[model samples]
Target: MTLPVSARMGGLAMAFRAMAYWLVRYRRTWRGTIVVSVANPILFLLAIGAGLGTLVEGSVEGASYLAFFAPGLLAAAALQNAFVEAGFVVNSALRRERIYSTAAATPLEPGHIFAGHLIFIALRLFLSAAAFVVAMALFGLIENIVVALAVTLAATLTGLAFATPLAAWAVTVADFPQLNTVFRFVVMPMYLFSGTFFSVEQLPGPLRAVAYALPLWHGVDLARTLALGTATLGMSLLHIGYLTALCAAGAMIARITYRRCLHE
Candidate 1:
């Protein structure tokens, strides 16, 4: 049965309340999240764009090493941090915290709870990407500051794409070891191969195809082009459409998974 409009609004309001609570709670631990977000681009830029860059004498795709690197790093950081926030944090809400249980007793539905978590994840990813953009700017890596908005949108959507699926899977995992295995085998490999540190064009044929299938590569490509002011509208739309599809599909699955997990 469908909920009435007023009831739906009430449920959404409860969801927003939950999202607000997360934002407030995050303030207490903002330092850790900020440090991690800031450190990733810096370490990668210093270690690769500056260090290994010294060895490679030519521009990558005609952009300086740091310029080519900045957007990819920003997108990768969003993927990593968003995966952690959505997976581990969602797991904690399901298990250690019993947050869903508490909310279930109230006016909120399981879908509302999941929606609230996704809202928080999206907001966190956007803010983190914006901060990283500023950091990249300070290092003189950004060619166009105006494109930060596009980069941030790409990063935010990319994060949500990962976040929803990870949240759904985390609900079914029996233990932390299983989750760690996913990171080791799945997340880490995507991070390394998704054109984050270098162009996927350098990858062998099959590997390049694999990178194209992954969501992060699309994000990296779009974000990098936006930062460099070189994206064609058609390509940008394709990337955005892929990420949006993943985000929508994953959110649906996460909603169903959350209902099952919370009910169990």
Candidate 2:
């Protein structure tokens, strides 16, 4: 039988409640989060966008390299922060802290638990992106403040595109070391090759193809375009579609994986 609307509403309430729990806990640790999510990215912007940007004499995509590079770093920082929350934190909740077990005993279903974490991840990315944008503004990198909204949204989507799948993968991991392996091999490589520092056009044909296949490239492109106010609507829609598809598919996979792994 189909569930009643009230029941569905209750499920959503439970999910948000679980998200609130995370937020409450995070408040105590917001300092570290700010340092990692906000400070580090700004430092990188200065180090690379300003420091190295000086040695570079040409414009990228008709803007200074600092202008071109800041947005990509914002998205990359979002992806990094979101993956940590969804991947390592979620895995710890399941295996180490066993909070999911306690949550499962309540009205919250496995899907609710998964959805709650996803929601928190989105929130985290938005906050991180906002902070990064403010930093960019301080550095005179942003042409228009309103563009930060679009860039933040893109960063959030980019983050979820990676986090959802990583969450599912985390559930199956045997130990912390394996997660490190994923970061060193997968995440780090993507960070380097996703057009964060340079255009994919600079890559060899084969490497460029690989960059095209990665979600970060799409995120970087969309964010760069939006931040620079140079995005064509058609291309922006295409990038949004690509990231949205990955997020939806990954969330579905995470739901299934959580059900199986958590025995929901």
Candidate lDDT values, in order? 0.83, 0.87
The true-versus-predicted C-alpha distance at residue 115 of model 2, in Å, is 1.0
Q: Considering every candidate listed, which one attains the maximal TM-score?
A: 2
Query: How do the residues 1-264 of candidate 1 rate in per-residue lDDT, one tens digit apiece?
Result: 998999889878878987877888898988887667666666777788778877776888888877888788888888888768887888888788887788778777788888888888888888888888877777776656566677788888888878888888787675867777888899889988999888899999999999999999998999898888889999999999998888888888887888898888
What number of clashing residue pairs does each candidate have, in the order they appear?
Answer: 0, 0
The residue-level lDDT of candidate 1 at 35 comes to 68
Per-model TM values vs. the true structure: 0.93, 0.95
In candidate 2, which residue ranges exceed 4 Å CA deviation? 1-4
RMSD of 1: 1.8
**TM-score of structure candidate 2:** 0.95
* Cα lDDT over the full model 1: 0.83
